[model samples]
Target: MKTPFIVLEGLEGAGKSTVLQVITQWLEQRGIDYLTVREPGGTPLAESLRELIKKDWDERVSPEAELLVMYAARVQLVNEVIKPALAQGRWVIGDRHDLSSQAYQGGGRQLSKNMLAQLSDMTLQGFKPDLTLYLDIEPAVGLARASARGALDRIEREALGFFERTRARYQELAAADPSIKTIDAEQTPEQVKAHVLAVLEAQWPS
Candidate 1:
Protein backbone atom coordinates (compact mmCIF):
# COMPACT_ATOMS: atom_id res chain seq x y z
CA MET A 1 0.00 0.00 0.00
CA LYS A 2 1.34 3.39 -0.94
CA THR A 3 1.53 6.01 1.74
CA PRO A 4 -0.97 8.83 1.74
CA PHE A 5 0.80 12.15 1.22
CA ILE A 6 -1.16 15.02 2.70
CA VAL A 7 -0.29 18.72 2.80
CA LEU A 8 -1.93 21.39 4.94
CA GLU A 9 -1.89 24.97 3.70
CA GLY A 10 -3.28 28.31 4.85
CA LEU A 11 -2.44 31.89 5.76
CA GLU A 12 -0.68 32.59 9.03
CA GLY A 13 -2.92 32.12 12.11
CA ALA A 14 -5.27 29.84 10.19
CA GLY A 15 -4.69 27.15 12.84
CA LYS A 16 -2.97 24.88 10.33
CA SER A 17 -0.49 23.67 12.91
CA THR A 18 -3.20 22.86 15.45
CA VAL A 19 -5.23 21.08 12.82
CA LEU A 20 -2.14 19.10 11.87
CA GLN A 21 -1.74 17.97 15.45
CA VAL A 22 -5.35 16.87 15.65
CA ILE A 23 -5.05 14.89 12.43
CA THR A 24 -1.91 13.23 13.69
CA GLN A 25 -3.72 12.24 16.86
CA TRP A 26 -6.57 10.84 14.81
CA LEU A 27 -4.16 8.69 12.81
CA GLU A 28 -2.45 7.50 15.97
CA GLN A 29 -5.80 6.54 17.50
CA ARG A 30 -6.49 4.43 14.42
CA GLY A 31 -3.08 2.77 14.79
CA ILE A 32 -1.98 4.05 11.44
CA ASP A 33 1.67 4.59 10.52
CA TYR A 34 2.45 8.21 9.72
CA LEU A 35 5.00 11.01 9.72
CA THR A 36 4.43 14.72 10.26
CA VAL A 37 6.89 17.22 8.85
CA ARG A 38 7.13 20.87 7.78
CA GLU A 39 8.64 22.17 4.60
CA PRO A 40 11.94 24.13 4.42
CA GLY A 41 13.10 22.24 7.52
CA GLY A 42 12.40 18.53 7.16
CA THR A 43 16.06 17.55 6.66
CA PRO A 44 19.33 18.84 8.07
CA LEU A 45 20.25 20.90 5.02
CA ALA A 46 16.72 22.15 4.59
CA GLU A 47 16.54 23.07 8.26
CA SER A 48 19.71 25.11 7.90
CA LEU A 49 18.24 26.91 4.94
CA ARG A 50 15.04 27.46 6.87
CA GLU A 51 16.90 29.34 9.58
CA LEU A 52 18.49 31.66 7.04
CA ILE A 53 15.26 32.15 5.17
CA LYS A 54 13.27 33.00 8.26
CA LYS A 55 15.99 34.93 10.07
CA ASP A 56 18.77 37.40 9.22
CA TRP A 57 16.60 40.46 8.80
CA ASP A 58 19.37 42.89 7.86
CA GLU A 59 19.24 42.24 4.12
CA ARG A 60 16.15 42.87 2.08
CA VAL A 61 15.40 39.52 0.45
CA SER A 62 14.41 39.63 -3.18
CA PRO A 63 11.49 37.66 -4.55
CA GLU A 64 13.75 35.61 -6.79
CA ALA A 65 16.07 34.85 -3.92
CA GLU A 66 13.19 33.72 -1.76
CA LEU A 67 11.86 31.52 -4.54
CA LEU A 68 15.22 29.88 -5.16
CA VAL A 69 15.91 29.29 -1.49
CA MET A 70 12.50 27.80 -0.92
CA TYR A 71 12.89 25.34 -3.78
CA ALA A 72 16.37 24.46 -2.65
CA ALA A 73 15.04 23.52 0.78
CA ARG A 74 12.10 21.70 -0.74
CA VAL A 75 14.33 19.62 -2.99
CA GLN A 76 16.42 18.57 -0.04
CA LEU A 77 13.33 17.75 2.04
CA VAL A 78 11.80 15.65 -0.73
CA ASN A 79 14.96 13.59 -1.20
CA GLU A 80 15.66 13.18 2.51
CA VAL A 81 12.30 12.98 4.29
CA ILE A 82 9.16 12.84 2.16
CA LYS A 83 10.25 10.28 -0.44
CA PRO A 84 11.65 7.79 2.06
CA ALA A 85 8.61 7.98 4.33
CA LEU A 86 6.31 7.37 1.40
CA ALA A 87 8.39 4.43 0.21
CA GLN A 88 7.91 2.90 3.66
CA GLY A 89 4.15 3.38 3.38
CA ARG A 90 3.92 5.92 6.17
CA TRP A 91 1.38 8.68 5.75
CA VAL A 92 3.14 12.07 5.59
CA ILE A 93 1.56 15.32 6.69
CA GLY A 94 3.32 18.52 5.75
CA ASP A 95 2.66 21.89 7.38
CA ARG A 96 3.14 23.62 4.04
CA HIS A 97 4.36 23.03 0.49
CA ASP A 98 4.72 24.48 -3.03
CA LEU A 99 1.44 26.28 -3.00
CA SER A 100 2.99 28.46 -0.32
CA SER A 101 5.45 29.85 -2.83
CA GLN A 102 2.72 30.54 -5.30
CA ALA A 103 0.78 32.48 -2.71
CA TYR A 104 3.63 34.22 -0.95
CA GLN A 105 6.00 34.91 -3.80
CA GLY A 106 3.74 34.93 -6.80
CA GLY A 107 0.99 36.84 -5.08
CA GLY A 108 2.65 38.68 -2.26
CA ARG A 109 5.94 39.51 -3.93
CA GLN A 110 4.31 39.75 -7.34
CA LEU A 111 6.74 37.35 -8.95
CA SER A 112 6.22 36.18 -12.47
CA LYS A 113 3.96 33.15 -12.70
CA ASN A 114 6.06 31.59 -15.45
CA MET A 115 9.19 31.76 -13.31
CA LEU A 116 7.47 30.16 -10.34
CA ALA A 117 6.04 27.45 -12.56
CA GLN A 118 9.46 26.60 -13.88
CA LEU A 119 10.95 26.42 -10.42
CA SER A 120 8.10 24.31 -9.12
CA ASP A 121 8.40 21.91 -12.02
CA MET A 122 12.12 21.50 -11.53
CA THR A 123 11.98 21.00 -7.77
CA LEU A 124 8.78 19.02 -7.31
CA GLN A 125 9.70 16.43 -9.95
CA GLY A 126 6.09 15.32 -10.40
CA PHE A 127 5.45 14.70 -6.71
CA LYS A 128 2.23 16.32 -5.51
CA PRO A 129 0.00 15.93 -2.50
CA ASP A 130 -2.70 13.28 -2.73
CA LEU A 131 -4.84 15.59 -0.67
CA THR A 132 -4.31 19.24 0.25
CA LEU A 133 -6.38 20.68 3.09
CA TYR A 134 -6.42 24.46 2.88
CA LEU A 135 -7.70 26.19 6.00
CA ASP A 136 -9.61 29.29 4.94
CA ILE A 137 -10.01 32.31 7.19
CA GLU A 138 -10.51 35.99 6.52
CA PRO A 139 -7.21 37.81 6.23
CA ALA A 140 -8.08 40.28 8.96
CA VAL A 141 -9.12 37.58 11.39
CA GLY A 142 -6.08 35.50 10.65
CA LEU A 143 -3.70 38.41 11.00
CA ALA A 144 -5.30 39.43 14.28
CA ARG A 145 -4.80 35.94 15.61
CA ALA A 146 -1.21 35.96 14.47
CA SER A 147 -0.45 39.36 15.99
CA ALA A 148 -1.98 38.29 19.29
CA ARG A 149 0.48 35.40 19.44
CA GLY A 150 3.52 37.74 19.80
CA ALA A 151 6.52 38.66 17.67
CA LEU A 152 6.26 37.88 13.98
CA ASP A 153 8.69 36.39 11.49
CA ARG A 154 9.86 38.19 8.34
CA ILE A 155 6.97 36.91 6.29
CA GLU A 156 4.57 37.10 9.20
CA ARG A 157 5.40 40.77 9.68
CA GLU A 158 4.04 41.67 6.24
CA ALA A 159 1.20 44.17 6.28
CA LEU A 160 -2.41 43.05 6.62
CA GLY A 161 -3.07 44.10 3.03
CA PHE A 162 -0.30 41.81 1.81
CA PHE A 163 -1.90 38.94 3.69
CA GLU A 164 -5.26 39.79 2.20
CA ARG A 165 -3.85 39.46 -1.26
CA THR A 166 -2.16 36.22 -0.35
CA ARG A 167 -5.35 34.83 1.14
CA ALA A 168 -7.28 35.76 -1.97
CA ARG A 169 -4.70 34.02 -4.11
CA TYR A 170 -5.02 30.87 -2.02
CA GLN A 171 -8.77 30.88 -2.42
CA GLU A 172 -8.41 31.31 -6.15
CA LEU A 173 -6.01 28.39 -6.38
CA ALA A 174 -8.31 26.17 -4.30
CA ALA A 175 -11.26 27.01 -6.49
CA ALA A 176 -9.32 26.02 -9.60
CA ASP A 177 -7.76 22.86 -8.18
CA PRO A 178 -10.00 19.93 -7.38
CA SER A 179 -7.40 18.13 -5.28
CA ILE A 180 -7.32 21.07 -2.85
CA LYS A 181 -10.16 21.22 -0.30
CA THR A 182 -10.90 24.48 1.48
CA ILE A 183 -11.92 24.29 5.14
CA ASP A 184 -13.46 27.16 7.02
CA ALA A 185 -10.93 28.02 9.71
CA GLU A 186 -12.82 30.81 11.40
CA GLN A 187 -14.38 28.36 13.85
CA THR A 188 -12.92 27.28 17.16
CA PRO A 189 -9.96 24.91 17.09
CA GLU A 190 -12.08 21.88 18.05
CA GLN A 191 -14.69 22.76 15.48
CA VAL A 192 -12.00 23.14 12.82
CA LYS A 193 -10.67 19.71 13.80
CA ALA A 194 -14.09 18.20 13.33
CA HIS A 195 -14.37 19.77 9.90
CA VAL A 196 -11.00 18.40 8.89
CA LEU A 197 -11.92 14.89 10.04
CA ALA A 198 -15.16 15.05 8.14
CA VAL A 199 -13.32 16.17 5.02
CA LEU A 200 -10.79 13.36 5.28
CA GLU A 201 -13.49 10.77 5.82
CA ALA A 202 -15.31 11.97 2.78
CA GLN A 203 -12.18 12.07 0.66
CA TRP A 204 -10.35 9.00 1.92
CA PRO A 205 -12.40 6.42 3.78
CA SER A 206 -10.77 3.89 6.07
Candidate 2:
Protein backbone atom coordinates (compact mmCIF):
# COMPACT_ATOMS: atom_id res chain seq x y z
CA MET A 1 0.00 0.00 0.00
CA LYS A 2 1.29 3.43 -0.85
CA THR A 3 1.71 5.63 2.20
CA PRO A 4 -0.31 8.78 2.62
CA PHE A 5 1.57 12.07 2.72
CA ILE A 6 0.26 14.48 5.31
CA VAL A 7 1.40 18.00 6.02
CA LEU A 8 0.43 20.25 8.92
CA GLU A 9 0.54 23.99 8.30
CA GLY A 10 -0.24 27.15 10.24
CA LEU A 11 1.17 30.37 11.62
CA GLU A 12 3.37 30.42 14.71
CA GLY A 13 1.64 29.34 17.94
CA ALA A 14 -1.34 27.96 16.05
CA GLY A 15 -0.76 24.54 17.71
CA LYS A 16 0.83 22.88 14.67
CA SER A 17 3.42 21.02 16.74
CA THR A 18 1.00 19.93 19.38
CA VAL A 19 -1.42 18.62 16.83
CA LEU A 20 1.44 16.85 15.12
CA GLN A 21 2.24 15.05 18.32
CA VAL A 22 -1.35 14.03 18.81
CA ILE A 23 -1.61 12.72 15.29
CA THR A 24 1.59 10.80 15.70
CA GLN A 25 0.24 9.13 18.78
CA TRP A 26 -2.99 8.33 17.02
CA LEU A 27 -1.11 6.79 14.14
CA GLU A 28 1.02 4.80 16.54
CA GLN A 29 -2.01 3.37 18.27
CA ARG A 30 -3.38 2.28 14.94
CA GLY A 31 -0.04 0.67 14.02
CA ILE A 32 0.21 2.87 10.99
CA ASP A 33 3.62 2.85 9.36
CA TYR A 34 4.87 6.43 9.31
CA LEU A 35 7.66 8.92 9.71
CA THR A 36 7.42 12.50 10.94
CA VAL A 37 9.66 15.31 9.76
CA ARG A 38 9.72 19.07 9.49
CA GLU A 39 10.55 21.37 6.62
CA PRO A 40 13.59 23.72 6.38
CA GLY A 41 15.44 21.31 8.66
CA GLY A 42 14.64 17.71 7.81
CA THR A 43 17.99 16.62 6.42
CA PRO A 44 21.37 17.58 7.77
CA LEU A 45 21.98 20.06 4.99
CA ALA A 46 18.50 21.42 5.43
CA GLU A 47 19.06 21.81 9.16
CA SER A 48 22.17 23.87 8.42
CA LEU A 49 20.11 26.00 6.10
CA ARG A 50 17.44 26.26 8.74
CA GLU A 51 19.93 27.69 11.20
CA LEU A 52 21.12 30.22 8.68
CA ILE A 53 17.58 31.26 7.88
CA LYS A 54 16.52 31.53 11.51
CA LYS A 55 19.59 33.29 12.81
CA ASP A 56 18.98 36.93 13.62
CA TRP A 57 16.95 38.41 10.82
CA ASP A 58 18.71 40.88 8.56
CA GLU A 59 16.87 43.83 7.07
CA ARG A 60 19.31 43.51 4.21
CA VAL A 61 18.12 40.04 3.22
CA SER A 62 16.18 40.50 0.04
CA PRO A 63 12.82 38.80 -0.39
CA GLU A 64 14.29 36.95 -3.33
CA ALA A 65 17.10 35.71 -1.14
CA GLU A 66 14.64 34.46 1.41
CA LEU A 67 12.61 32.65 -1.21
CA LEU A 68 15.67 31.09 -2.77
CA VAL A 69 17.02 29.85 0.54
CA MET A 70 13.67 28.31 1.47
CA TYR A 71 13.37 26.50 -1.84
CA ALA A 72 16.96 25.45 -1.63
CA ALA A 73 16.33 23.88 1.74
CA ARG A 74 13.13 22.34 0.49
CA VAL A 75 14.84 20.86 -2.53
CA GLN A 76 17.40 19.23 -0.32
CA LEU A 77 14.75 17.98 2.09
CA VAL A 78 12.70 16.48 -0.72
CA ASN A 79 15.64 14.74 -2.29
CA GLU A 80 17.06 13.46 0.98
CA VAL A 81 14.11 12.87 3.31
CA ILE A 82 10.55 13.17 1.95
CA LYS A 83 10.97 11.32 -1.32
CA PRO A 84 12.90 8.45 0.15
CA ALA A 85 10.48 7.88 3.01
CA LEU A 86 7.44 7.89 0.76
CA ALA A 87 9.17 5.61 -1.71
CA GLN A 88 9.59 3.09 1.09
CA GLY A 89 5.83 3.17 1.79
CA ARG A 90 6.20 5.12 4.99
CA TRP A 91 3.60 7.78 5.61
CA VAL A 92 5.37 11.12 6.02
CA ILE A 93 4.04 13.84 8.26
CA GLY A 94 5.52 17.24 7.67
CA ASP A 95 5.35 20.05 10.19
CA ARG A 96 5.37 22.62 7.42
CA HIS A 97 5.72 22.55 3.66
CA ASP A 98 5.75 24.71 0.52
CA LEU A 99 2.54 26.50 1.40
CA SER A 100 4.64 28.11 4.09
CA SER A 101 6.68 29.85 1.44
CA GLN A 102 3.52 31.05 -0.24
CA ALA A 103 2.27 32.45 3.04
CA TYR A 104 5.48 33.89 4.43
CA GLN A 105 7.33 35.00 1.33
CA GLY A 106 4.71 35.48 -1.32
CA GLY A 107 2.17 36.94 1.09
CA GLY A 108 4.14 38.29 4.01
CA ARG A 109 7.03 39.65 2.00
CA GLN A 110 4.74 40.79 -0.82
CA LEU A 111 6.81 39.06 -3.45
CA SER A 112 5.52 38.54 -6.96
CA LYS A 113 3.15 35.58 -7.07
CA ASN A 114 4.22 34.87 -10.65
CA MET A 115 7.81 34.58 -9.57
CA LEU A 116 6.93 32.37 -6.63
CA ALA A 117 4.81 30.07 -8.75
CA GLN A 118 7.50 29.80 -11.39
CA LEU A 119 10.09 28.95 -8.80
CA SER A 120 7.86 26.33 -7.20
CA ASP A 121 7.16 24.75 -10.54
CA MET A 122 10.80 24.58 -11.43
CA THR A 123 12.04 23.27 -8.10
CA LEU A 124 9.30 21.25 -6.40
CA GLN A 125 8.21 19.38 -9.51
CA GLY A 126 4.56 19.37 -8.41
CA PHE A 127 4.98 17.51 -5.14
CA LYS A 128 2.06 18.41 -2.85
CA PRO A 129 0.42 17.23 0.32
CA ASP A 130 -2.28 14.58 0.10
CA LEU A 131 -3.86 16.17 3.15
CA THR A 132 -2.95 19.47 4.76
CA LEU A 133 -4.38 20.39 8.15
CA TYR A 134 -4.26 24.12 8.69
CA LEU A 135 -4.71 25.34 12.25
CA ASP A 136 -6.34 28.72 11.94
CA ILE A 137 -6.18 31.30 14.71
CA GLU A 138 -6.30 35.05 15.06
CA PRO A 139 -2.94 36.73 14.73
CA ALA A 140 -3.09 38.43 18.14
CA VAL A 141 -4.19 35.28 19.93
CA GLY A 142 -1.58 33.16 18.23
CA LEU A 143 1.19 35.66 18.89
CA ALA A 144 0.26 35.91 22.53
CA ARG A 145 0.54 32.13 22.86
CA ALA A 146 3.90 32.28 21.14
CA SER A 147 5.12 35.10 23.33
CA ALA A 148 4.26 33.25 26.47
CA ARG A 149 6.41 30.35 25.37
CA GLY A 150 9.76 32.22 25.30
CA ALA A 151 11.89 34.83 23.62
CA LEU A 152 10.96 35.15 19.96
CA ASP A 153 13.24 33.98 17.21
CA ARG A 154 13.98 35.95 14.07
CA ILE A 155 10.85 34.84 12.24
CA GLU A 156 8.80 34.78 15.44
CA ARG A 157 9.79 38.36 16.24
CA GLU A 158 8.10 39.70 13.12
CA ALA A 159 5.33 42.20 13.81
CA LEU A 160 1.78 41.04 14.52
CA GLY A 161 0.78 42.59 11.21
CA PHE A 162 3.14 40.27 9.41
CA PHE A 163 1.56 37.24 11.08
CA GLU A 164 -1.86 38.62 10.24
CA ARG A 165 -0.88 38.71 6.61
CA THR A 166 0.49 35.20 6.85
CA ARG A 167 -2.68 33.92 8.49
CA ALA A 168 -4.81 35.49 5.78
CA ARG A 169 -2.67 33.91 3.12
CA TYR A 170 -3.14 30.50 4.75
CA GLN A 171 -6.89 30.96 4.66
CA GLU A 172 -6.74 31.89 0.99
CA LEU A 173 -4.76 28.77 0.18
CA ALA A 174 -7.15 26.54 2.15
CA ALA A 175 -10.05 28.12 0.34
CA ALA A 176 -8.43 27.47 -3.00
CA ASP A 177 -7.55 23.85 -2.30
CA PRO A 178 -9.95 21.18 -1.12
CA SER A 179 -7.05 19.10 0.15
CA ILE A 180 -6.36 21.75 2.76
CA LYS A 181 -8.66 21.61 5.80
CA THR A 182 -8.96 24.51 8.18
CA ILE A 183 -9.29 23.82 11.92
CA ASP A 184 -10.06 26.41 14.54
CA ALA A 185 -7.04 26.45 16.85
CA GLU A 186 -8.46 28.72 19.55
CA GLN A 187 -10.00 25.70 21.25
CA THR A 188 -8.21 23.60 23.83
CA PRO A 189 -5.50 21.24 22.65
CA GLU A 190 -7.74 18.20 23.06
CA GLN A 191 -10.50 19.82 21.07
CA VAL A 192 -8.09 20.77 18.31
CA LYS A 193 -6.73 17.22 18.25
CA ALA A 194 -10.22 15.82 17.94
CA HIS A 195 -10.96 18.07 14.99
CA VAL A 196 -7.80 16.93 13.25
CA LEU A 197 -8.63 13.28 13.85
CA ALA A 198 -12.12 13.77 12.46
CA VAL A 199 -10.68 15.36 9.33
CA LEU A 200 -8.31 12.48 8.81
CA GLU A 201 -11.03 9.92 9.30
CA ALA A 202 -13.25 11.67 6.81
CA GLN A 203 -10.50 11.92 4.23
CA TRP A 204 -8.95 8.50 4.69
CA PRO A 205 -11.85 6.38 5.83
CA SER A 206 -11.17 2.71 5.35
Give lDDT per model, in order.
0.88, 0.88
TM-score of each: 0.96, 0.96
Candidate 1: residue pairs that collide: none
Q: How close is candidate 1 to the true structure, as a TM-score?
A: 0.96
Clashes of 1: 0
- Model 2 residue 128 lDDT score: 87
lDDT digits (tens) for residues 89-142 of candidate 1 = 899999999999999888888888899898888888778998999999988888
Instruction: Write down the lDDT that model 2 would get.
Output: 0.88
Report the error of model 1 at residue 103, Å: 0.7
Off by over 4 Å in 2: 57-59
Report the lDDT of model 2 for residue 115. 94
Q: Among all windows of ten consecutive residues in candidate 2, which has the lowest summed lDDT?
A: 54-63
